[model samples]
Target: MDPTHADLERFCAELKAMWEACGPPVLTSVEKYGGPKKSQVSTILNGDITTVPDIDNVAAILKACLANARAKGLEPPANAEFDYWKGRLGSLTRARSNHSEPGPAGNPWRDLAGTHPVWESTTDREFFRPRVVKAAAHLFDRRRRAATVLAGDDWLDETLAQRMTDRMGDLLTGRLASPAIRFGGVEASLIVLAPLLHQVRVAESAAALIGVRPIELRPSASAGPLRSDYERFLAGSEQSRLVARTELTGVPGRTGAKNEIGWWLFHQWVMRRQDPVPTATAPHDLPIAEEPLRTVLAGTLDRLVKLFHLSPDGLRNKERRNLVHKVSHPSITPALQDVRELLVGLLLVTAHKLAVELTALPSTIVEHLGIPNPVDLGRLRALLTGMTWQPLEVIGIGLYAQCHHEAVLEALLAHVRQTDAVLGSVRDVATDRVHLEPLLRLPPRASADFVTPAPHPDNHTRPAFVVPVTRFRIDETRVRELLMGEQLYSDRSLAIRELYQNALDACRYKQARHRYRAALEDT
Candidate 1:
């Protein structure tokens, strides 16, 4: 189907050569058979003018193919002439054998099937009388003709022996088996079952072995072949399923609370000074959040801003925008809440990858940050434009949503405890970073927004808590050196995670560092 008409023309040309190589027979009486003379045989050959192919030549080709095919257990030609022709070529000839077997008396199959008149019945017609008859006849005709041309006067005796030997060989090779056949619907019959014609019969034994009762296997609808992957896809192995579940839920003791570590890391980073330790309230009149929370929140905000490539709130108009601005007007708040979620997840995942890399078996750092679900990545996306949020891949929408919810839970919990202002366990969230916004979305509570000291520009992206993995005295040069080597630090996740882990160690082991609960204790 993919081929064009040109391909068909080329195939027809090849057919012409094959016909010439084969000595095909035509009905002949040396005079009665009428058609073009030898001089006008162009109809049977390729030339400028196209003509119908010679019927006899096509028949011979088909017969030869069928004979070969029948020997190989493939389908064969349908016409009776071809089947007899196959038997003739396959078996040796003898005077005692059928005359038409291989001598151009046409084919036996056609005569037996009444395809030819009774008087015109060929030696080929009588040859198929016995399954072995054609084999003997074909051998005689060929060997006798060959011996006359090769061994001279001794042709008769010598040819008989040679022809018999050749026929026996056909027996062993199965070329002496069933006659040629062709495409037809349920068309086999015992009368048609005879030696194939025109094909070379190699070993005589093959003829003896064929045409035996065939085996037919009962078809089973369900017993078909299957793909190799079938079993794996269907079978729910305990180990693989377990892995899938762990990855989906992010195992509680695994990836959840790494965010809490951020809260801790932030505090330590803002102030590397360990002695006469800097306090959150130590900065004179500044009423920052409790010691560690203030510094941690501030540092975390700085990191978030950096992670998103957001311009600091104060820095502006550095990059070109869609419209010209007078340094006077600013677009709406760049969304920061949505951006925070992605950064937080990256931090958590980074921590997990680190733990596996370092072979560090830290328990439950992420689990502590198990935020609620319905991870509203979609809702959060809208919020970003409303708040002038920073850059964050949308993929982390679900993650940020969960983190945002976690923060809300922490905030609600903190509010109730600090002011003895008990509210029902939060049912639904209206906005991120819980404000005095009433539970009802309708009339914004007059006190809903941060009415007290407003959040600082630097504090916009900062979440309530984050933890760093570790902290130690190191020159800025040393920190950079480790980064360059990817040894002591990696990215935010590694640096922040290590800092947090260190702070936790410092908090628990007083002997490890100066005791500083101000940085960690929930303010």
Candidate 2:
């Protein structure tokens, strides 16, 4: 697939090796087994092709080779062999067209995708998944309620709070909803809560975000399975995007606003940022509907709050305070149970929101963002219709919990307990006033006890035997022999040939890096 045909030749050579390993079946026999025509098979097996072969032909040849391998009583490749080769085929296909425009064929957006800013809308059902919309609604609900709570609790200016909270209530719970909420309130609420909300750290938040090792959650534990799950999700997201990319980009006239709207939905809904919609590097500003955007976000928050079992609005000030209360405070340590639940819920909403946003974008853009395609939009509607989003019970727990929530929750609970114990122990005996000085001033005492052995009157000698665990160690001389000796190569000239091949491969790899800036940046 490479422009120089090096990769294509390498692929053919590998196929030839596979064919030879399978007793070097005749071209006719391979063709009989549903492979390409005899002449084409011969050319392919000869490893002299200049162009990338058709995928169907490659698949057929692989099948025939696999069949021959099986007939010779040899061990067949793993079940994923087909998939592995299929991926290689896809890579080759992309490499073949590396110089082509990005995005779907015949689309002008393909040319403009990277040069111009993208547009997105959170309210667009076509763009956002239902659950994401639902999640956004919930977030909106919380922000408004939080604003109202701050107002009633005298945290904000009374008049401003009143304007924000007015008519934003549900009749049943005496709370507010999206339709009644004002744009001023939405913006104000976001600014006001940004500080507190930003400070609220869930132990697994970083792990969830980066698929990195659990940093805040675990003090000493390894990242464990978290990284792999996140990696898998990312891989799957990319795969899904690739599968659906052509269709998405093929949507006619997809130059400016739609792309921006999709990205905005992703950033605001999935990433949960309140920044204004992005502008193009071009001089002109894109016309974005501000009031509608604010309305959609407000709605999603309200829905999410209800999902969290909180009132939409009204005098839920105490409950709101507890929701955002700092987790480290000893007085409110037990309140972390609810906090964990809320955090988990937020994660769920974000996950669904992310899934929706990615599914709506073109493959190139999705690849650029490295976002997850968690659900197939086509099937998601039918699948999620009967389902209710529950954070504590079920939903995203299988993958999200292992990678993010589960360990962090346990660690958080343990941390709370430990803090409570330390604080409890430092209480003054006479004055009964809690003293904080000892905690900072004194060194930590050992949690476990140690004792010295009593003297042995007989003075008898005792020996301890420990079992040895052996590991393979490479000898320096042997490594040198392996590298330079005739053990590996009968002809010394073969070594020079391999080195030259490796040099060429390195050049090809560098060229590939130059072709895909996004992938290069990620690495």
lDDT by residue for model 2 over 1-523, one digit each (tens)?
2232665676677767777776666667766656788898999878767777777777777777677776787654322144446555654454344323333442221222211111111122232232222322332333333332222111111121111121111110121122432212222222222211221111012212333421121122444554444334334433333323323544553222223323222222222323322221111111223444344333333333332222223112335424331122122112221112232223222222212221222232223221222211212122112112121222111112111112222332232233223322222210231221211211121111111121221221421121134534455456767887778888999988998999999999999878798777888
Q: How many backbone clashes does candidate 2 have?
A: 33
User: Any runs in candidate 1 off by more than 4 Å, and if so which?
Assistant: 1-310, 313-315, 318-322, 325-406, 409-523
Candidate 2: 10-residue stretch with minimal lDDT:
114-123
- Clashes (N, CA, C under 3 Å) per candidate: 88, 33
Highest TM-score against the true fold, candidate: 2
lDDT of 1 by residue, 22-46 (tens): 3332323111233444433434334
Give all candidates' CA lDDT scores: 0.27, 0.34
Off by over 4 Å in 2: 1-4, 77-80, 101-393, 397-523
Which structure among the candidates has the greatest lDDT? Answer: 2
lDDT of 2 at 68: 70
